[model samples]
Target: MLNSNMLRKLDMQDLMVFVAVYEQSSVTEVSEALCVSQSTVSYCLKKLRTSFENELFVNTRSGMLPTSKATAMYPHILSILKIINTCHSGIPAFDPTQKEITFNVCAPEYFELLILPKLVKRFIGSRFPVIINITKFHRDIPADELMEGRFDLVICFGPNFHRGVKGLRSQVLLEDELVCVVDKNFTLAEEAFSLETFVACQHVFPTPWTSDTNMIDGWLARQGYNRQIVARANSYVAALNMIAGTDFILTLPRRIQALTCDENTFSHRRPPAGLPNFTLDMMWSEKPSQDSANSWFREQIIKVCAEDGLL
Candidate 1:
């Protein structure tokens, strides 16, 4: 049995390592799960042995087997640890006005233009330090980077694969509808956009990392018609700029159209009919975060969305 001194001397983190290795039957597996080095796991195991007065595990032909003494200690030890962990599940509040922590936000260009600016002003006025990394939204994800805490939060399209990292938190950001855009001075042959106009007009299709250009191609394939692509880009901003000067048309989200059209600047701007809508989501690795700070930031985002009629 592990006495009070044994428990006191053994850090809970080391015990967790020991428990994970015990259950997994391998140090390599536990090291990967905990995102730590194999040497660190081995070191923790040695400490556990010294505290427990026995080899907690013995390598057998089948697997690393936990000793009888170690088996006896599992139940009460795991229960107490679980209770301690449950108490920490709550996400904390963050008062940006006073904090000086650097937060990293990952997103596609759309969020950078439509979402980041407003959030940055709030951050600066509140004195919170931050950095934004703009990467193509369609790149193959690096799952280990997420486990290693590369990004504080991701502003992305719905669906992510890195949910096993223990502290993941996700929220649906908003449902954005698509719109048709053209230069204010440009004129279509018809006053109202029709299916025939959509099919015949020279089109500017933007490729944002996910092979969306290909998806769009597929969507239009069955129709026996497709847009003539005059230009393409992985960035939405580029597409927006190109559409501002030509007779060609581009599809954009309503929020973007809302920001881009200042009746004075784009008097003829309008979204065409028959495009689909999609949702954007906000996600974070929630586990290692300080609880109060998490709660505060998340609520602020939600509050801002509601105030702006963005939800």
Candidate 2:
């Protein structure tokens, strides 16, 4: 940190001269560009060295070159000067409806069936003139990648976070009770999801984390049940395909249960008849522009899901 007085009293001309000479690599060139004598450029470099407490530049056969300290200061000085200019004017205006923008949204594929359609409609109604590119989400992506701006937003099951990243808010976007789904043309009844039947059937699980193998097992232990996860996959589609036309049952979000509702032949059973529900959430990095967008998007999501009484 630097003192306010030191900052106020420092010679701005010296930095300008140093930057010009360093960039041009010729004091003669700098002097000519600034319409000053070469001696004046040398004098300013000397004064800059004293203020910086280090040699700000070193002379080479070609011309002058920046020391490490000066090199480090270059970017910060440029950013500060630009920010000063921008502050005087205010933030650049952005109108989503007409601006050409690329938005990167990351989320589980399960979200495709429920929230994604409304998100598209909201964009259409807003007349947002931008393409939305959605990419895959995995548990393995580090939170730092999202925080450091690689992603505009990441939607996941939340309550876990890293420091310096509490800017965006979180809401229970959807509540899904885990239910058991089986292949159509099967005889298993929804009412038969007793503890014994649950433990007896082969199961397919969708889990991204190896650590999660223990979480569901632990939950089963609470109900005095033990089930086998004969197959595990990272996707619901894969799990659905594997469990099709088989005795295998899948414990998954109820929205998934609705996906196969057209196959009315399939049946579902609630775990223990009273297990707590699971909630999925949308998480975004906090930003000034996100305030209104977040509220609007969340409302649209709730509205669509509520229309189906699924929220």
Give per-model TM-scores.
Answer: 0.59, 0.58
lDDT of 1 by residue, 182-211 (tens): 777767645546666776777777665564
- lDDT (CA) for every model shown? 0.67, 0.67
The global Cα lDDT (0 to 1) of model 1 is 0.67
Give the Å shift of residue 211 in candidate 2.
6.4
In angstroms, give how far residue 47 of model 1 lies from its true place.
42
lDDT of 1 at 233: 64
Task: At residue 283, give the lDDT of candidate 1.
Answer: 69
